[model samples]
Target: MHKTKKNKKYTGKIYRYTMLVFVISFLILNSFVHWQMQLQKQTKEAKATYTAETMVQRIETYLNQYQTKSVLLKQIVESDENMNMVKFETLADFIIKGNRALRGIELAKDGIVSEVYPVESNAQAIGLDILTYPARKDYAALAKKSGEYVMAGPLELIQGGTGMLLINPVYTVGAASEKSFWGFTILVLDWDTVIEELNLDGLDDSFYHYRIWNMDIRTGKQNLLIEYGDDGLKDELLVSCDMRNDTWYVEIEPVNGWFSTTEFLVNSMICILLSLFFAVLFLQYAIHRQEEFAHHEEMMRAAKEIQEANEVKSRFLFNMSHDLRTPINAVIGFTELLERHSDDEKKVTDYVKKIQLSSNILLSIINHVLEMSRIENGKESLNEDTESVKELIRTIDAVFETTSRQKNITCEYHVDVIHEYAVFDMTKVEEIFLNIMSNAVKYTPEGGHITADVTEVCEKDHKALYRITIQDTGIGMSEEFIPHLFEPFARERTSTESKVLGTGLGMPIVKALVELMGGTVNVESKVGCGTKISVELFFEIADGKRAEESDQKQEISSTEGIENLAGRRILLAEDNPLNAEITVTLLEESGLSVDHAEDGKMCIEMLHQKEAGYYAAILMDIQMPQMDGYQAARAIRKADDAYASIPIIAMTANAFEEDRKLALESGMNDYIAKPIRMEIVLDVLKQWI
Candidate 1:
């Protein structure tokens, strides 16, 4: 009887332990399955959003290209009011030949279509009064009223099929320079051809269904254009693309819905199996618990470290964002002031100067950010060139002379070097010194003294070790802050509190560049007293003959006369209309006649069509739609024609040492970084032309 009682007790214990293990395992497995389902749904939704956005961008770009062409046609018509049908046909043929999506081009005279390209099949569109058409008249009127381009339809076309119409209103200039409406320049885009060109149908796959539609503005109802899958779409993921006068929506959803029933069933079965397996192996789990505990502790430490790093980055970003906005806000505010006080000459002048100052500050912040990014990504490299130590010091002095004088600060520089010229990365060395000096000047109170001392420490193996020390009687940092002084976005005081403007990336950049050049940097500061920074760098002594040759070349280059630039004609190849307009204005203001090309391809064609000596130079932008500046430069050089030797200067926003080198390598005569100052442009132009 006692033996029977013990057996019963043992069986009850086993049953209880098994049930506990099964319950725990089932709960965990079910939670994991739920988590997996949520993750899958999130991933699908993200992908759908991405796909929708991509389609929108592609369609917008396609539409914008036709809009640009339409504007170009309008410009041609307005320039020559007597443009005959033969001339119109020739221009239309050129515009429509390469693009398969274009159905045809039409010229409407006073809202009546009088001309159509490819007159055979599209003749039916000729003489059709577009303004009288019920479906098209509203958009036509809108185009005329707004004095801008307007888009209409996926409506039935007289030439057959469905298409969209881009209407650009043309205006004629009378003898008194009065403008009158001259009807429209219309571009017909075939809907099916657009879909085929953009591969819209291919976006749908086994995993997802998509629908594209436009809203009818008149009726406030969705006009479904294309769908790939089921009859009813839930509009789970929707993205709107804005065209000229309409917004098109792309909606996407998972084919199997957000949660898959089949997947859920499979996961549930696996969870059940896993629960049973865990119950069977419950006794063995205790054996490995100690090992798992140790692993968990290690994982926790790693996660803590990762979190700390993330927090640091977050803090840095927060500080940078605040610092970046100060100058930007100043620029924006001053611009508004300038606009409001346009008639006041003195206020306008003052506001313009303030705007320029703010712009410079904004540029400095951007430069610091870019420099830090390059350093962090390990993309920065030394471009070693022979540089004069005296010249470097002179340049720095010249830069700060005005600011120091304005603030009543006495800034002095002392240099004692055995070698005057050394082979070093001039840009990097200049940046390091400039960054330190700028901070010293910024923080130093008015009437305070600042000094920069440069001396040769030692020489070995034909390399000279130079030491630079900058000292300032300024608001020094706290002892505790010194440790984090070289960290990115580290600042001693907030700009608002200190009344100082800076990105806080300067010192970090200085430290990074110093380290990159196999150098050391040290700082000494006391809160009430002052701050002094010392940097030691080694540079190879440049060959005397080479240094002399470089100096002579620089002298000769600087002496080149820019007077010849007056009345000179040059080609400005740029894609953006605003940039092109700004550049043309600047060039024209400098007494130079400018001919603008929309892209590299157009620039090349214009060159080919012009006389050999017509254009004195070509200012080519590096990034353009068809054939970039590099390819254009190379082509021009390889043509071996009379114009092949024409000077091509790269005027682009790609402002980096490597970019300049690449431009030169691609047969460009010179490179001009944009935000183009007229003086720099003229200097560069004078050298080549």
Candidate 2:
């Protein structure tokens, strides 16, 4: 009797569990169906929003293309040098050539398209009436009226769907609007291109239908310009344009965006329910917590492994750099010495050039590494201040004057000094001027003129500021490279082929600095012509308007610290023998008094005991073992007796320019470098003396 009762109890327990599972499965499945329907509805609304925005962006992109192409075409029509009948004939030839070259630029003349770019399948459009055409005629008329820019709303084609056009009126030189309207330049674009690029195919397996509509909410023109799919599911949108410039871009564009996807939700519900069902079966309530703990531990172990590897990588790079710089410096320095002492003049010149090239490479690697460190450390902060226009320009001129003269390129400077001072970071200003000027000189073929001008643009609000325009008659850049000019590690099409290519960090650095200083950079160029870079800095009227000086005769002579070092025998307090050797070489070349002291203690001993006129200055190294330059300078400055009068200049391998200022601020007279330049030593001496 007891055995039978126990069997019945076991059967009842099994029955209860099976019934419970059945009931739960039924409830979950029904709930999933309801949730999927809601998800589809939400997807539909999201898709609608995305579609609205993406459509706007597509229209804007096409409009921009139209505007640019129209400008190019107008220039062809209106140039005085190209207005003759033969030139016009040549222009027609150019039109054909350009059309064949580019995918999206077309040219129309006298209401007839002589050339349509790409020479696509449609040849019937050639010699057709562009004026009477359904797409371009209206925009051409507006261009005639405005003489500026005219954009058309999206229009539906009589044959099928939607299109858009932009027009600009091209005028001849001094050509009256009535006489020189030169038939309007029309830019035609099809919006379907955007749809083709952004459509989602293999990513989603659900019902999603996407369509794009321009945000012509203002123009009252809601012509459906693009549609992505024919599925009944809600559409998705990726990007939209009617927002803030940076945030204005729409992503998860329409048609694939928040669109009703009943199928997607149903599938998702199936996944969630399946997950819960398995979770309940395999995982007991107590074991579920234990499984979570185990998963966390596994993740932590993986994370720890990655962290250890990263630490090792970091150490490796650090050690590699430390090891590499020593050999590199030795190679470069000895190579320079060999080139200098070489008997053959040509070989000497070759070696000298090679040394320069090698030094540039070393400098590039250093800058890249240093830049990475600075970014990681958050140290590249903008320290802005008001700077003098004349001083700034003169400093820039001093830097590039020799190079410019070498190329026989006369640089004419026009400074609107009346608006004298600008509130910007001086360091950044120097960088911007130097980079642009260097490129201008490098790119402008020999003998080309470079002009840098600053003018006060009259503002409507009675607030006037400075406009610094640096225009070079150098080999200008291609239109394609313009967008990427400011990207780091990006060399232009010309830059790559030219012998003057740099580390490619200059322009990006310039842009970052300018933005930090609250300024903007503008560029315009034509291939084979020249490039003009106009940088507009926000200036506060601090020093009053200085005059516009087209030419300034101020010259930066090869400095020897000549005056500062005059009769001042500098006490060379350096511990490193290699650094001491280089210092002695540069000092002798600059014609200065340099007395060697092995370390800071020796420096103090020599200064304490030396005769009154034995030393006039001390070029201290900041990181000496016995005592650093800062401490030595402070001790010398604090000296009560005769030694206090002698000046100390810190010579350091630290290339941060601010370090020099820091040395001076710490009671030192000036600072120079370890691998010192003869000119710099001379300049420092002249200034201090």
Estimate every model's Cα lDDT from 0 to 1.
0.82, 0.61
TM-score of 1: 0.40
Minimum summed lDDT over a 10-residue window in model 1 is located at 285-294
Candidate 1 lDDT tens digits, 1-689: 98667656766666688789999999998998899788777877888888877777777887899988998999999999899988998999999988999989999999999999888868999888878887788878889989999877777898899998899999998889899999999999999998788876565455668777888655677877767776567646787777667788988888778876656776798899999998878644543343344478885786689789989988676656633554455566666567657899998997777676556555655565566768778886777888888877875674565567656789999999999889887667777887788888888998899999999999999999999999999999899999999877778798897888766777887888898899999999999688999999999998889689668755554334335677899999999999999999988877889999998899999999987899999999999997999999999999978999999999999988789999999999999887877767878887787
- Write the residue-wise lDDT of candidate 2 on 1-689 in tens digits: 88667656755655566556656775776677668657666655565555555455554663464466567667766765245545554654464343321223344566676654434532445676656765556556656767776655445523234444455666655535455555655454444543344343433323345444444433445545544455433333445455211123332333444423544564556656775675466334334334344478785776588779989986656433431342254345546446446787776775565455445444544544455446435566656555667776765564455567656688988787555655555555655776677678778887799998878776434335567788988878889999999876677753447766455555776676666656789999998889999887665454333222112211333442544454557788888888888888667655666788887888998888887767766788888888888888888888887878676778788778678788987789877765665665666666665
**TM-score list, all predictions:** 0.40, 0.34
Each model's total of backbone clashes: 0, 44
**Shift in Å, residue 39, candidate 2:** 78
The model with the greatest TM-score is: 1
